[model samples]
Target: MVIDRRSVQRAALVVLPLVLFVAARAVSAVGDGPLQNGNFEDSPDQSQMSGSVVAGEHAISGWKTSGHIELVCSGQKQGDMVLTVPDGAQALRLGAGASIEQQISGLTQGSYYSLTFAASRTCSQDETLSVTAAPAPSGAGSPAPAQTGELPMQTVYTSIGWDSYSWAFRAEGAGLMSVVITHNCGQEEDPACGPIVDAFAIKALHDQPPDQAAADNNMLRNGGFEEGPYIPPGSPWGVLVPPVDEDPVSPLPGWKVMAYKKSVRYVDSAHFAVPRGARAVELVSGVEAALLQEVDTTVEGSWYRLEFSAGDAANGCASSSDGSSSSGMKLKAYAGTSETTVDIDFRGAGGSNRGKIEFRAAASPTRVVFVSLGYHTKSDNSGTLCGPVVDDVSLVPIPPPYARRLLL
Candidate 1:
């Protein structure tokens, strides 16, 4: 055994690289962008299921389930209600402490990633869903801290029962990461009560810091609503960005949803009539829904003009058969301490009207906020709240001459 030490060393060197190469290929094979079987359309085997309840942790394809998890079919009847699946023909219902998770690979360390999923409450109005992401079990170091966010499902922002929501977190480590969605509702009387979840997808968010260079003179980043989380294909209802206070990192960069219980709907041109670019934010929650951004100004107390486009997403909000909405939409724009309201009359189709407001900065970084003034619903009588779409936001300093004249 003591002979040929040099041969042994050479063998070790050759085998090490081969092992590393194979390991790298295995990691890349997972294809980190899309979550496998995210829509829950892949049904479990009959042996693994007792009726709709899945028995084992590995029963669901491409996922690990725990506690009481059930596969729900679209239009499944329960008493007088029919369950609606948000994506595809099937969805998952987590009961009590139950959760479903899958490990995603190809993540870049220190980069931000956002999870976009469609969910709706069931059984009780107080139902909430908790989403958490942490580095997968590894022998290296202690692993990064887990990021979690509890979403309140009491508010339904779409005509359908389900709404697509986005949650963001920063990846502290590369390699594989585990993403789990659990039902937070702990109703002992009915352990089956939980939220229906579907359409799980993730998007890597590019850095769009407030001070980042803009495409135009607009001080705000992503002002055109071009950069955002991935929208599940064919999702007519846009993704809802939860309040900034709850999620801190928004899927829609450079902007924050102000209300704790409200969200701003991020719509696409394919789904909703976007005013500008390929995307826009629809203020669907009336006054509860507000978007805010802070941008640096040239000088403190200097006048600045906040210009933006506001219009209907052409979602049939209060529409009449004659081709026009019955009511107009109003948006209140706030620049620093001063504010102004803009009213855009609906003209049946999707279109935008330009509006501007001049206000003193009061400080170098002024807070810009947009709040929908009135409540609106689709003309089809779906009872879904719909409102004006805001896009192409720009803030620039006003010349002294124009400022003085406007002041007078």
Candidate 2:
């Protein structure tokens, strides 16, 4: 008829923590609801023609469209050819000077929100899309104040197919905000001439200390070069042969090919050996075939570390004496205005080589560039070009010594 007080205390210690953890998770899930129909899968009106959503009417249930907008479904007609939705069964076809707007609620003031989406060119050779979010109008009866601190406009070129993009902005002084996606392409006679948008999403970033957030979040997008608009015939792998020119602005999704001289091979573990992930970029085109990415830094004036793996492709195409092939590759890394170069030589074929660089961000946004500077000369007179392989690239902000001690 007696109870053990120690046993009761032990049960309480375990049960109390479990209950608290479950409650915390439930609260987090409630806050994770979608801000809009980001995938554009809901189409109440089965219409494909332009201006299907009448003026002052909601398009696709949760969005309001201005000017001309079409809810394009798969297998729909766009002028003379059939149009296919990129992300889902349905997508928004924005006409020239057209826009789609939605109001996001339940946001925390002074918190940061990240917006992401997929966009592609539909009718034109190239298209630019701008996304803006600001505090909602004060009231239905009162005039709204001037808006400030809009995110930078993003331009997407469609030749590479559908590309994914992300941007972050801070919410100031309001719990509600309005998000607008506008097509900024020039006017054309065809109604289908605009950008195709799909899979839009907005999420509030977790409340973490500045230094911790920087350390946890990667500043570079697609640093591994895994996400690209197109998947080559050797899926997850693509080859960019010599004389194939690519724009330096955006050679692939979230990457730029700065100086492509010969051929560069995109390798994936699925098709070929890779240093990390499903894909890695190989310098098969010889020297000057470089890749770079520019990303906004959350922590300015703070030291950040660049880490990556480099090695030779060992494809037996590189030229060398004694009938053996060697990959003599050099990598040049630039962080903002400061620059450094490292020579990479594979001790043997497919040897593991690692490299690291540390730099401070001098500005709010920083440019991190990697260029190939070495080429292998041919001995067999095959005229084939070969160079080093680079993969698993990452840039992470380094916390100060004092902060590290505090965390420990």
Candidate 3:
């Protein structure tokens, strides 16, 4: 058969973005704003980081810096100060100011980087700051290739206190880095004397391939399970009705009776419903309960809970009772879409005790109800109904029919 060229091209077009996503690691880093760091070396105290702004005086602060940064002011327009990160993380970010001075060493033999300043106060609409490393390029003497990305943050003049701003920056070329955070405080300050600067940290992302960069933001300090899936805070629970019933169960309720015989028995009958999106059904047995026999759905038109007795634990298909539980009753769950009719079977082994057998459906029915808790002897004598015991039966909605429930 001849293959269609257009089809192949379309498929490639769909997959091209995914292929390029492999380079997601090629992003830039950020540093605490100048309000906290005068020279990025030590950690800045967010509390002590505060101070009032004078009309023309720029109050800057920052910590965890290997470089220097300046601050910004409101009410007037000013230039910026470019921060320099000599080597590893050119740990440098700016507040409100203009590029004033930059001194980076070892760049002639390696790479270098710098950070741009954030917007000033009164620019409430401005959310974050941006920084880029202008590559002194062409020759091999370029310190490291500068990272090209934006820091998604902003901290201008607030009504009362100050908001902290910081980001992480990275350099590839191994050399001394130069950085300067440009700042321009408003030329007009009224009564405030302290513009607070918050604290920040520089935890290294792994030295592994850059592809893991985004995921690195969420890795645990101890290295365990991956970050959460960001499920909604209010995602609701599931819905299942008409529980299973069994004789000789533990903790007998006022509504149901105990098992009549030790040889084989069933439950007091139950009324249950299967909400949309259920996945699997459960059948619990006592130690005495034999392998599930004839564990089939309810004869109530649509399918219901599975039925099992002491005798039918063998092949969980349809089988006749052989008098002895050795050949105990054998039943099966009809795996099919009420409309699709896909045949699936459940056994004593497939979730016989704690596990569940899968079931499927086609339409998004409002409910696939069931009558849970109907079974027989777990064994000849083992799981006999003595004291209050427990037996369960639940309807498992397979894929298409699967949906979660929401609480009011």
Consecutive 10-residue window with the lowest summed lDDT within model 1: 317-326
Error of 3 at 101 (Å): 7.2
RMSD per model, one decimal: 4.2, 12.9, 26.8
Clashing pairs in 1: none
Local accuracy of candidate 2 as per-residue lDDT tens digits, 102-197: 777667776666565666666654455666667777655653332322111222212345544444455644567777888877546775477777
- Could you say which candidate leads in lDDT? 1
Off by over 4 Å in 3: 1-124, 133-144, 152-161, 182-201, 207-408
User: What local lDDT does model 2 show for residue 269?
Assistant: 67
Task: Give each model's whole-structure lDDT.
Answer: 0.81, 0.59, 0.26
Cα shift from native, residue 389, model 1 (Å): 0.6
Taking all chains together, each candidate's TM-score versus the true structure is 0.88, 0.52, 0.24
Which digits, one per residue and each the tens of the lDDT, describe model 3 over residues 235-325?
Answer: 1211101111332111111111112111112112121111111222222222222212122332222322222111212223222222343
Q: Which candidate is the best by TM-score?
A: 1
lDDT of 1 by residue, 1-408 (tens): 567989989999999999999998875554324578888888888899999999978988899999888899999976888989987899998898889999887777777788899898777777788889898878878988898887778888766788988988776676578898888884546888788888888888875455555545667778888888888777788888888675567788788888867788888999888878898999888888789998864478688888999887887875332345447778889888888888777743678888788887778778899998877777777777788889988887788998999778
Ranking by TM-score: 1, 2, 3
Residue 263 lDDT (model 1): 83
